[model samples]
Target: MKKYLDIISDLGEGFGSYSIADDSSLLALVSSANIACGFHAGDPRTMASAVEKSIENNVGVGAHPGFPDLVGFGRRAMDLSSWEVTTDILYQIGALHAFVKAYGGELQHVTPHGKLGNFSVVDQRYAKAIAEGIAMFDPSLIVVTMPGELAEAAKKKGLRVAYTIFADRTYNDDGTLVARSNPHAVIRDPDTVVERVIRMVNEGKVTSITGKEIEVNGHSLLLHGDTPGSLQLAKQIKNALMSAEIEIRRLGDWIN
Candidate 1:
């Protein structure tokens, strides 16, 4: 545990450039940043600014691609063909990579956001499509995915996989996240979030909403920057992990 913790911050719609939470404190606490790529939120300017800030803070930058549903904020599921999903991913990654290159930085990873990520996990064909898209873009780029299903698919496709877990979210008995629509899904309490993360890192387990302890292989921990009290929770999570002898680092440093 002391050598393998990567803290990530999700920069979504509610916490874009126009929001109060998009600032240095959040950037400082996180080692990897998932920046929205215009589908769910963020424009060209916001993406460029976020990329610049991430580089300035020496944090790893990744593209946060989502469904093309601005009205739904990419949270609502949509029926998309595998090819369509693959093309969407390529467009989003290309958009962010251009900004990163302009700033003399590299796009380190790709994390599908919202409904796309949820659907990809349960649908192996969708997962493979996403993996192929990432592999096509650059074989060296890592794919940050939900720890179990999508990560396995990406690995099978020979893409470097970053198995990600969420610090501010609840898990199901099978290690999938409790649906966001559920009342217990989002862990709003900072102390609880810290404790859950520590247990996941040290014991390789997460207590699900049903009180079942499920095994989890978390290569990285995600903190949703748009969630209420997210920055405070991130600080507490990092401190607790460090106290427990877990060393937090960027995902790029761990990927082969």
Candidate 2:
């Protein structure tokens, strides 16, 4: 049987006079968007604009909070206490929530960004902090995370969770993503990504870089907006899923 999946992408990842990929094109393809919350790559204006665009496109709005690393684009790890991580995530969610409310759209989810995201997956303390932070904001909101400490923390904190797997990134045998330092971390070929995503959803598994078959839960599939030709790749993946008769919708709409 064909598997249903939710499509999500990053948005609002540009500062003044600097833009990344065309977010408008991606908005047309994804059902949910994880908008950057100014710490990583977005500014206030950019966050507001992304929220507005998401509202116009009828896409689910989510907070994409990361480390306070503008220089490293939040991909570099930082030395932060669990309380600090929780507060940082809370602040970003509040910032994005204002935009979401002003645009007459409810915030649907929270997804940690970059290094913060990867860390939350491994460190139970950080994961619990993130989940606690989201619970403080809105317990009804969903947390998009991989199957690990973050997911466990979210569930234990009485927050909703939707398991997320990457469509264009390779996983490790331990179910973590391959280190970005490796040259082959991201799978850029559009056709290959589409096929891999199909397998993940339909077969409930993905092949790790070490040739291990690792099972994956697929409440949502993520595609990085900053990737080359990401817009076309997202479109093709959505089309491919549709052709396979997989129901692609927003996490908020389907998680229940």
Q: In terms of lDDT, which candidate is strongest?
A: 2
Lowest summed lDDT across 10 adjacent residues in model 2 is found at 1-10
Compare the candidates by TM-score and give the number of the best one.
2
Regions of candidate 1 where Cα sits further than 4 Å from its true position? 12-17
Backbone clashes counted, model 1:
0
- TM-score of each predicted structure versus truth: 0.95, 0.97
Q: What is the lDDT of residue 108 in candidate 2?
A: 95
- Residue 3 in candidate 1, Cα distance off native in Å: 2.2
> lDDT, candidate 2, residue 86?
87
List the global CA lDDT of all models.
Answer: 0.83, 0.91
lDDT of 2 by residue, 1-256 (tens): 5466889999999998798979898899989999999999999899989999999999999999999999999999898998999899989999999999899999999999999999899998889899989998889999999888999999998888898899999999988999999988999788889999999988889999989999998788998888878888888889888988999888887686
After superposing candidate 2, which stretches have Cα over 4 Å from the reference?
Answer: none
Q: Model 1: clashing residue pairs?
A: none
